[model samples]
Structures are given as C-alpha cells and as structure tokens.
Target: MIGIIDYGMGNLFSVSKALERIGVPYIISDSPEELNKTKGVILPGVGAFKDAMARLQEKELDQFIHQYVDSGRPLLGICLGMQLLFEESEENGRFQGLGLLKGRIVRIPDRDQNGERLKVPHMGWNKLHFHQEAPVLHDIQDGYVYFVHSYYADGIDEQALLASAEYGVQVPAVVGQGNVSGMQFHPEKSSATGMQLLTNFAKAMERSEELL
Candidate 1:
C-alpha cells in the first residue's frame, strides 16, 4: 500500500489517477497514522515552498515524513514536494525546507554568458539524461517529462544527482540519494513516458531495500 500525502497542495487527482492507471494500490491521506504504516510515501505538491511547509507543519506530518524517509523506506517527492526535500528555498524569501537532501532551490539565470532572457518558470517537456544507471529510472529510457517550476535545486553535489534535462540550460530533472528520490517534473502529466517512470517508482517502492 503506497500512501500519497494529501497536504491540500499537490496535483492530487492527476497523481492519484496515474497511480491507479499503473494498477498500483494507493491511499491519499493527511493523517500521520496512515503515513507511518504505508510501505512507501509520496509527497506531491504544486505550490509555494513556504506555504507547503507551513501546511505540513500545521497538519503535523512533517516529522512523520522525515522519520519515514530516514527509516530507509522509499520516499518520492514530486514538484514542489521535491523542493521541500531540500535544505531551503528562496521563493518568496529564505525559508527552511525538510532538509532530506542537502541543497537549496534557485531559479535559472535569465541570461547566459552571452546574455538573453531565458524565462523564469520553465514550462514544457524535456528529456532526462541519467547521471548513472539506477532503478528509479530503470525500464525507462531518456524521455520527456513535464516540468513547470521557477526555482531549481542548486549546490547539490554530482553524487546525489540522478538525471538532467535541457531547457536552454541543463536542469537536474531527477534526483536521488539513497532511499530518498525526487523529480522536478510531474510524471503524472508527462504522458506515456511519465507513466512508465511512475511504474518504475512503484516497483522501487516495493523493494525491501534499495539496490543503489
């Protein structure tokens, strides 16, 4: 039984529907009790970083999420959920994150070395170039995943990065460090490729322990 954290901020219907499409049994709930017992937990969100953290805290599920990930069980964060896994974000101002991964979120440079308006929120589909062969992206080749975000995680070492995507610049699309995994793109909205990636994630979640 996989649990999707229902913090009232995620793309709930799309994510839930996608999981169902893969024939994976899942429950969406905000209760900590249910979260503690689930085989795997998915933190999905589509909103501001500071607001999401506040709601998670208000619901008292932040600590439980941390404990679940720390327990070595597979925990995946999607979109804004991915940002929460980092140390902090500068969306509105400097705000602390869940610190599941050692990094901070920053937007892409408006201009390159040559100088040009590259745009802020990167909204479109892009391919993921795997940093190294791993199970999270197993059975999945480099393909496009839907992304729509202004802030990108930065200062992360090469070791923790799983995949990169092109958007005028290379953005870390998929990231993993041990049992914790995250995707800047919304797999639920990436069509066939996205569906396959989610299926892979479900299988990874079922594993007793990650193979690395």
Candidate 2:
C-alpha cells in the first residue's frame, strides 16, 4: 500500500481518485506513524511553499520524510509537493525545503531568451522530454502531461534531471535520484500518460519490497 502524506495542504481528492483508477492501494493521513507503515509514500501538495514547510515542520513530518527516504523505500512528490523536495524556493521569498534533491525553485521566466513575453503559471498540457532513466519512468515515452504552476526548479544537477518541458524556459518536469523521485505535473489528471507513470511507480514499489 502507498501512503499519501496529508499535511493539510494536499490535493488529496484528485490524487486519491487517480490512484483508485489505477487500482493502487493508498491511505491518506497526517500522522507520520500511520504513513510509515506503508510500502511507499507520496507527498502531494497544492499551496504556498513557505506554508507547506511550516505545516511539515509542525507535524515533524519533515524528519519522518528524511528517515523514510534513508530507509531505502520510495518517495514521490507531485506538483507543489515536488518543489518541496528541493533545497529551497523563492516563491514568496527564500525558504528552505526538504532538500531531498539538489536545486532551488524559482518563478518561470516572464520572457524567453528572445525577450518575447511569456505566460506565467504555465497552466495546461505540455510535452515531456525525457533526460535519464528512472523506475518511475519505466516504459514511459515522451508524452504530454498536465502542468499548473508558475515556479520551476533550477540549477539541478544533470544526474537528477529525468525529464523537462519547454515553457519559455526549460522547466524541470520529472526528477529523481535513487529512492526518491518527483513530478511537476499532475499525473492523476494527465490521461493515459499520467496513469502509466503511476502504474510504473507501483511496480517500482513492489520491486523495492522484494529486495527487503
């Protein structure tokens, strides 16, 4: 079973429904103890970075997350949840993050290199461009996924970059390193491509269990 970390700021409804459609067992909870029992954990969020970190610290879920990843289990962050995996974000001002992955989150450029005006938030579907291999991306091909955020990750090491999308700038879309991975898109709402990614994650979790 998968544990969807509910730190009072997750898109719990959509995420849970998506998992259900794929037949992946999941439980939602704010208690780290309850979540710790699951085979894998998913950190999903839909709010401000500063506020999200504050909540995680309040519940000590931040420490729980670090411990969980250190145990060799899998952890996947989605959307704002994905950004929280980084070291810091410049959303409302510089603020520390979970630091599970290297890099920082910043606002998408208002203009491309050509200085042409570009849209902020970047809401809608964008095609994914794969960079490296990952279990979560197993058998996954380049396809469109739903994205709805203004900030994107930057300065990420090449090894951790799994995929990206062009949106006035090269936005880090899918990122992973070892037992941890993240997606900037809403896979649950992203049609067949999204479902495939989640299914792949489930398969990866099963493999991790086997190793234990």
Candidate 3:
C-alpha cells in the first residue's frame, strides 16, 4: 500500500484517483504512524513553497519524511512536492527545502535565450528527454507530459536527473536518487504516459518488497 502524505496541501483527490485507476492501494493520512505502515509514500503538493514547508514543519511531517527516506523506503514527490525535495527554494524569499536532493528551486525566467519575454508559469504539454535509467521511467520513452509550474529546479546534481523538458531552459522534470524520487509534471494528469509512470512506480515498490 502507498501512503499519500496530507499536510493540508496537494491535489490529493486527483492523485488518489489515479492510484485507484491503477489499482494501487493507498491511504491519505496526516499521521506519520499511519504513513509508516505503508510500503511507499508519495508527497503531493500544489501551493507556495514557504507555506507548504511551514505546514510540513508544523505537522512535524518533515522529520518523518527525512527519516522514512533514510530507512531506504521509496518516496516520490509530485510537482510542488518535487520542489520541496530540493535543498532550498527562492520562491517568496529564500526557504529551506526537504534537502532530499542536491539542488535549488527558482522561478522560471521570464526571458528566452534571445532575451525575449516568455510566459511565467510554463503550462501545457512538453516533451521529456531522458537522462538515465530509472524504475519509475520503465517503458517510458520520449513523450510529452503536462506541466503547470512557474518555478523550476536548478543547480541539481546531474546524476539524479532522470528526465527534463525544454522551455527555453532545461527544466528538471523527473529526478531520483536511491529510494527518493520526484516529478515536476503531474503524472496523474499526463494521460497514458502518466499512468504508465505511476504504474511503474507501483511495480517498483512491489519489486522492492520482494527483495525484502
């Protein structure tokens, strides 16, 4: 079973529905004890970085998450949740992140390579370019994924980057290191490719369990 951490943020309904469609059992919980009973955990969020971090800290979920990851259990962060996996973010002033991965989050530049003004939030479908092999990316070749975010991760360790999208910049889309992983795009909203990715993650969790 998967545990969806709920600290009063995230598109929980959509994420839970996706898991249901995939036939993966999951529970939404704010209690760390309940989350500890799950095989894998997913952190999903859709809100401001500072506020989200504040809530996580308020609930003491931050410590639980760090400890969970340290135990070598699989943890996936989606969208804003993904950004929280980084070391820090510059959105609405400098704020520390979960620090699961070595990187910083910054707002997507408003200018293109030629200094042309571009849209702030890079919304819509974008093609993914794979950087390395990962279980979450199994059977997922090149394809477009839905993205709706104004800020993007930067200065990330290239080794942890699994996929990226170009929107006048190399936006970190899929990133993973060991049992911890993150997706900037909402896989639950990315159609077939998204479903496949989620399915892959579920399978990966099963494989991990089998090994144990």
Q: Quick one: ranking by lDDT, best first?
A: 3, 2, 1
Q: What would the TM-scores of all predictions be? A: 0.95, 0.98, 0.98
The alpha-carbon deviation from the true structure for residue 75 of candidate 1, after best TM-score superposition, in angstroms, is: 0.6
Q: Regarding TM-score, does 1 or 3 come out ahead?
A: 3
lDDT tens digits by residue: candidate 2, 11-126: 89999999999999999988989998999999999989999999999999999999999988999999999999999999999999999999999999899999999988899999
CA shift of 7, model 1, Å: 1.0
Best by lDDT: 3
- State which candidate, 1 or 2, has the greater lDDT: 2
RMSD of 1: 1.8
**Candidate 1's residue-wise lDDT over 1-212, tens digit each?**
78999999998999999999989989999999987778888999998999999999999889999888778888899999988999999988999999989899987777765676787788888778888777888777658888999888998868889998876667888888988889999999999888998888888877844442
Residue-wise lDDT of candidate 3 within 99-175, one digit each (tens)?
A: 99999999999998999998979999999999998989989865789999999999999899999999889999999
Residue pairs whose backbone atoms clash in candidate 3: none
For model 2, give the 10-residue run with minimal summed lDDT: 133-142
Residue 173's lDDT in candidate 2 = 93
